[model samples]
Target: MLINDNQEQIAIATYGLTKIYERNIAVNEVDLQIKQGEVYGLIGPNGAGKTTLIRMLATAEEPTKGEIYLNGDRLLQDDTNPHLKQYLGYLPDDFPLYDDLNVIDYLDYFARLYKLSKPLRKQRLQEVLETVNLENKRNSPIATLSRGMKQRLSLARTIIHQPIILLLDEPVSGLDPIARLEFRQAIKLLQQAGMTILISSHVLSDLAELCTSIGIMELGCLVENSSLDNLYQKFSKQQILISTLGEYDKLEQQLKNCPLIEHWEKLSQKNHYLAHFTGNLEDASELLKQLIKADIPLHNFHCEKENLETIFLNLGHQQTS
Candidate 1:
């Protein structure tokens, strides 16, 4: 379904994207664009190709240099579109099923291998076993479930063929914080059924609380690709923290008469203060309206939004220093 049913985009564009094996370079050249229903996150570490650029955007390899645009069509994953496998639904960080197929006959054997018809494959296998709740483990025994019910029966076979773009490798890797909160409420019920995910996880706070745009592969190269508030408003550096209702030596002598606070210190006692933002937010908002017109007792203030594991350890310590 080459997206454009009034543009419900599910993007994954790339260019200059490279990959190599025997001779090294796992990923490089990478440029990116990921939008659609946007849950995009692909952080790095562990040989940082982020699983070979998500196995070449789930086309399952083939791209020593590249192009990938899911909803904007231009397909491949051995393209021969049988509705492009109902719009991709890969789940590969080892999501192989059929241990004597049980959970509703393994989602009615992939909804009749996506051929669907037998009463719409029993209505999309009872609607993906109630969107992965696994309705009473629908006749259990995929080898006695539980590794979080076999990761919610592999997300009910990656949404029994209703795939509107999903590629979730490491989908809750070996759960058990109550099955990773029931597989994060079955991926927030597949993003409220609008689906368009592209997750990868080494759990960075569960992809910083279930992604809202991210793309940070390292060695393979597309370092950061936006929106976690535009990647901390374009690579962070807006840290403000002032906690004084009274003397931190008169708020560090009224913040050393506010010189657009390029840097300040005293992180404890005398009250507490910290500042750094020479990126000059209009001289740090005219030094916070001249400390509220010199009343000074600003009891508390905090502004620390540069977290995604602190922008993934400051971009892996600025690419290994």
Candidate 2:
């Protein structure tokens, strides 16, 4: 279940959304709700059904049983509601590009396909090119661009029609560090544009930096879904780092004396230690006061929360065999 504000408008929702093959249930009954303008990250191990759920939402694949909604309107796979397609931009992991066409021409082609007026197409092409930082390569052939550029070009094509919601699957799969950083920047720009984006990626660190909320999948079931803040509050372990100029032994003894500290570890740096803190800010302050009273030359003291990756691994969700 998703922990969301009741007042927030839901841009995408699913009810009992499921998919099945001959013997395997690719996606179990999943009830998901994503608020408008939210960057919702989906993470899980291989064969966890993340792709299947995304495909169903993109209308590329039909669900065996379930209902999908956008802005409170039911979405049907049939062509009866063409307007619904206009509201969504779906980019699969393997996105095709016209290698022969120039960047501008390629975007123009998709814009025309979406029935954008010539004047509007011209305007939108420039906007998208700028958004993806591909303005310099507007006239460059798609085949000449690097892997990262190709991905950004594909993203530009996806948004050429100005879709309100975007569904992206493993957008940064095989790119190098620089390429991945570029892609992340483009996604941030899109988010600032107020597009509700659902992204699935194995890169938890990127998701940690990008997503407003996250949903974890395992064996076709959504086992966890919550806002980042809420997830941190509930699952993140707090630790305190203390750097002192005084004697290490004295600092260690002081930490051992504190009941609020579960345990402490000596760091590689001189006179620096990490303590597993179990109390609130007030308790931390009291501990700091005690250290000062003991004449420990404390130079730095601060709390560090567990990151998304640590919390995810600690949850013990494994990939399908």
Candidate 3:
């Protein structure tokens, strides 16, 4: 498991943040807090307000109610604050591009817009190209780049100004597996450089591999929020997989009286059973000893934990039901 410091500085925070559209609450009241240097994943099904929440964070859409803060400064009250623009970067799922411009020129244009000095812009352009692994394609026309390449290019543009916070909405929507992995690597690099990121994606596997923490949204409400470890601990079952060399009927008869075993299921045709063992490591060891004393031939014993998908589904079901 990856360990992170809870004492890290707050990067983005929203309190009672809400959005309404024509009497519809697109985004109900949401209270989100993300720490600096952490990669936070926002996950939900279609029309779950994931994009709307991100838009509010990016300041692209104003909230009907509530407050938002970035680096301890109020964001809702400041439209002319150049510092907000300089410190926050927002990338939507479909990023519009200047087809006439090549990769290098595209990055250079944004750098200039940020008022970066000419010499510094040149340096930053090279750095971002390298960061996104687009250095070799710097001279390629934006229209000629592949889909994955274009996505990387868009990310390069987002980070070229060295934004302290990034709000990415489905950044890896249509990429192949390898391309998604590459994108994950680029985001890790940025995290190492101390950029706090809030990313939304339906690709739970990618989010599982990348995010330090996750927030599950359902029906425009934040249903679950916790670190990956905490979520796992909450949903994980203390089950044991035991393989025995004896007949299943005999094993069942011998073990029916075991109070510590809550339930059991046969795994395939193999001489294996998954038992819900409600016990710690020491208790499990004792149970194994008891089984041995009872003349049961035990070949293997190990604990199992529920995976991310299961936890995600459970949370969604709990909210909807």
Candidate 4:
């Protein structure tokens, strides 16, 4: 279900957007809506049509049917609606960069292409370099940078025009742990700056950390779309971990009495137990109260919500070849 927050303005909306190649439907009547300043994560398997949808949104590939709107303005592939392009910045999985040009020069070239004035170009170049943490490599050749640095540079180029909406397709495809961390930090900084971002990546952990909302696509169709909180409330199972200083058997007996607890198992650690809780916060609180009343010598009791991967798998939308 699409979130309808009347107070928030829609940054991007697509009505029955679709793309077809031969008899194969690349995107099947997708009606996507993203609010301004939202970090929307798109997730699916390799052949899920995420790239096709994003390419259509970027105006890089024209959709065979449907209409795209940017801030209430219809986005046209033709030259008549050229101004709509300014509000968008798209970064594909593989982007071409000028290997011979230094970082600053390459950014300047794109800035000029976007028709930014000389003064604005200079200001934006510096700002984007700083945003991506590439200030030190401003004069370094693109070919000399590491894979992570190159990705960051590509991102800087995408945002050099300071677009209100950013589209990223697998922005962290190949990078070491440290590099991915750095790239994630850059994305957080961008989110803090209030740019509506839509990112499609196989990294569910990253998406869990960054996305305000998530959409799951399968076989060219969007099967799930919801705000992260709602999705969690609806699908994520709540688990409670308890550590007691008292005997494990006594704790187990007390847990068995509680109807809210579906089941529980002893942890590898002594006197630690993990319980599958089937209730809301208040029920969990009542369980804690009952445990205390039973004098189980509870030392640690905390809830652990199911992570994104667990939720995704539980929803039965596993990737297919």
Give the whole-model CA lDDT for all candidates, comma-separated.
0.76, 0.92, 0.85, 0.91
Model 4 lDDT vs. the true structure? 0.91
Clashing pairs in 1: 9-36, 27-220, 248-270
Return the candidate ranking by TM-score, descending: 2, 4, 3, 1
Q: Give lDDT tens digits, candidate 4, residues 1-321.
A: 233567678888999999999999989999999998999999887888999999999999999999999988899999998778988999999889889999999999999999999999989998999999999999999999999999999999999998989999999997888888999999999999999999999889999999999999888999899999998988889999999997677789888988888899998998889999999899999999988888888999999898888887766544442
**Any runs in candidate 1 off by more than 4 Å, and if so which?**
1-18, 21-41, 44-52, 57-59, 63-88, 91-113, 117-120, 125-158, 162-186, 189-206, 211-216, 221-240, 245-249, 253-298, 301-306
Following a full C-alpha superposition, what root-mean-square deviation does model 2 have from the true structure? Answer: 3.3
Q: Pick the candidate with the highest TM-score.
A: 2
Q: How close is candidate 1 to the true structure, as a TM-score?
A: 0.35
What's the TM-score of every candidate structure?
0.35, 0.88, 0.84, 0.85
Candidate 3 clashing pairs, residues 3+ apart or interchain: none
Instruction: Identify the runs in model 2 with alpha carbons over 4 angstroms from their true place.
Output: 1-5, 243-250, 266-272, 292-300, 317-321
Give, for candidate 2, the lowest lDDT window spanning 10 residues.
312-321
Candidate 3 wrong stretches, greater than 4 Å: 1-8, 239-277, 283-302
lDDT of 2 by residue, 101-204 (tens): 99999999999999999999999999999999999999999999999999999999999999999999999999998999999999999999899999999989
Candidate 4 versus truth, CA RMSD in Å, comes to 3.5
Better of 3 and 4 by lDDT: 4
Candidate 4, residue 5: Cα displacement in angstroms equals 6.2
